[model samples]
Target: MSMVVTSPDFRWGLKFFKYLEIAKVNYFTNTTYLANFLSKSIMVVLRIWIFTQLYRVTYATANENEIGGLTVPMVIWGLMIAQSLNTATRPQLSKLIDEEVKSGVIAYSINRPYSYILFHYFGSMGRFVSNLISNLTLGFLAAFILVGPISLSWNGLLLGSLLLFFGYTLDFLIDLMIGLISFWVEDISAFNWIYSKSQLIFGGLILPLSLFPDYLRNIAELLPFSQLFYSGSRLIVNFDFQLFQKYLLIQMAWLVFFWLLVGYVFSKGIKHVSVNGG
Candidate 1:
C-alpha cells in the first residue's frame, strides 16, 4: 500500500501522540488564567459546603448512620467528584462548534485533511484536564476541611479513575452533539438549557442516585446522563467493581449509540454546510 500519513488510523501512534501534545498544551494554557475559572472554582467550594451542611442536618435529624447505604461523608465526597466532572470541561466546547457553524468557519474545516471532530476533541481535552484537576483540587480541599479525611483504597482510586475517563469521554460526545445542532438552528441556547437540566435532574449531579427512591434510581441509572456524572461519582466514593463493570457496559453501549448518532448528525450537518456554499 502507498504511504498514508493524513488519516488518524494510518500510523495511529503518531496521530495519538499529536492529540496528546494538544491536550498538554491545553492543560498548561488553562493553568495560566486562574481568574477565568474563579466562578466555577468558587462554586465548587460553595456547593461542597452547602451539600455537606445540608446532609449533615438530614442525617442528624433522621438519626441514621446511612440512608440507602450511603453516609454523609460519602455524599460530600461524591458531590465533589460529580461537580468537578460536571464543571471541569469548558461548556464552551459545544459553543466552539456552534460558533464555527454560525460563522461558516466549519465549512473550511470540513474539507480539511484531518477529521474536524477529532481536532476539537484533542483541542478541548487539554483545557478539560486542566479544569478537571483544578476543580478536583478545590473540591477535595473543601471536602477535607468540611469533613476531615476519607479512607480510600488504591484499587478503588485506580478503577474509579477509569470510570471517570469513560464518563468524561461520553460527556464530551454529548456536548459535541449539542454543538452540531447549530447547523440547523440559528441558536443552540435552548438545546443547551435542555441538556444542562437533564444532567441535573437525571444525572444526579446534586443528589446521588442512591438516595433516590428505588423506582427513580432504577430509571435514572439506565440513562447516559447518569453515566456521565452519577456512575463515576458514585464509584469514586463507593467503589464497586461489579458496578464499575456494569457502568462500563452501559457507558460503552451509550458510546456506540452516540458514536453512530454523531456520525449521522455530522454527516447530515455537513451536507448543510455544502448547501450553504461552505
Candidate 2:
C-alpha cells in the first residue's frame, strides 16, 4: 500500500485559501457585513471632503507655499495618510468584544483551541486590511482632485509606510486593551465614547500635532496617542531621523505596557468570570 504525503507549506497554503473562500461566502450571505462596508465607505468619503475643504481654506488664507514648513501638497498628503491610518485602526473591534461578553459567548471562545487574543487580533487585522485598501483608494482620489498631487522622497515614503504599520499595531493593541475592560465593567459604552473623543482630540486625527498649542501639544507628545499619527505624518512630510527614533521608542514602550496590562486583566477576568447561573 502506498500513502500520499503533503508538505506543510502546501497544507498551510491550502488552508489559507479555503479560509478566504469561506470568508467570501460569508460576506455575500451576510447583510450586516454589506451594511458595515457601505457605512464605512460613506464615512470615508465624508471625512475626505471635510478635510479637503479645511485644507483649501487654510491654504487660501495663508500662503499656499507656507504653513508648518510644509507646502499645500505636503499638508494634503499628511492629511490623507492620517485619514488612512484612522480608517485602518478605528476601534470597531471593541463593539464585537462587548457583544460577546454581554451574550456570555466569551466562555465558548475561551474553550476554543486557539487563544482568544490571537484570534481577535487576526480577525480584526483582516477587516482592517480590507477597509484600508478601500478607504485609501477613495481618499487618495478625492484628495488628489481637491488638493493636487503630493510629492515624497523615496526614502521618506519607505519610512512613512513602516511608521504607519507600527502605528496601526500600537493603536490596535490599545483599542483591544480598552475593549478587554468590558469583561469586568457592566457597561462599556461610556468608555467607548470617551475613547473615541480622546482619539479625535489628542490623536492628531483632524489637525497636525505641531499646530496644537504648546501645552496641549506637549501633552499629546507625551502620550501614546500622538505616536499613532504624529510619527507617521511627520515622516511623510518632514522626515527627521532623531524624531523618528524617539517616536518609535514611545510606540514600543506603549506596546509592551499594553501587552502586560491585557495579560493581567485576562488572567483575573478568566478566574472570576461567572456565567449567569454557572
Provide the clash count, candidate 2: 0
Q: In model 2, which regions exceed 4 Å deviation?
A: 1-35, 276-278
Residue 107, candidate 2: how far off, in angstroms?
0.5
Best model number under lDDT: 1
Q: Name every residue pair that clashes in candidate 1.
A: none
For model 1, residues 1-278, the per-residue Cα lDDT tens digits are 55567666777988788778877887787777778866687788998898998999988999998987688898899888888878887656788899888787887887876788888888888887778777888888899999887778776788788878888889888999999998888889999989888999988788888889999988888899898877877877877888888888999999999989998999888888843552
Clash list (residue pairs), candidate 2: none
| Local distance difference test scores for all models | 0.84, 0.73
Top candidate by TM-score = 1
Our model 1 lands, by Cα RMSD against the true structure, at 2.7
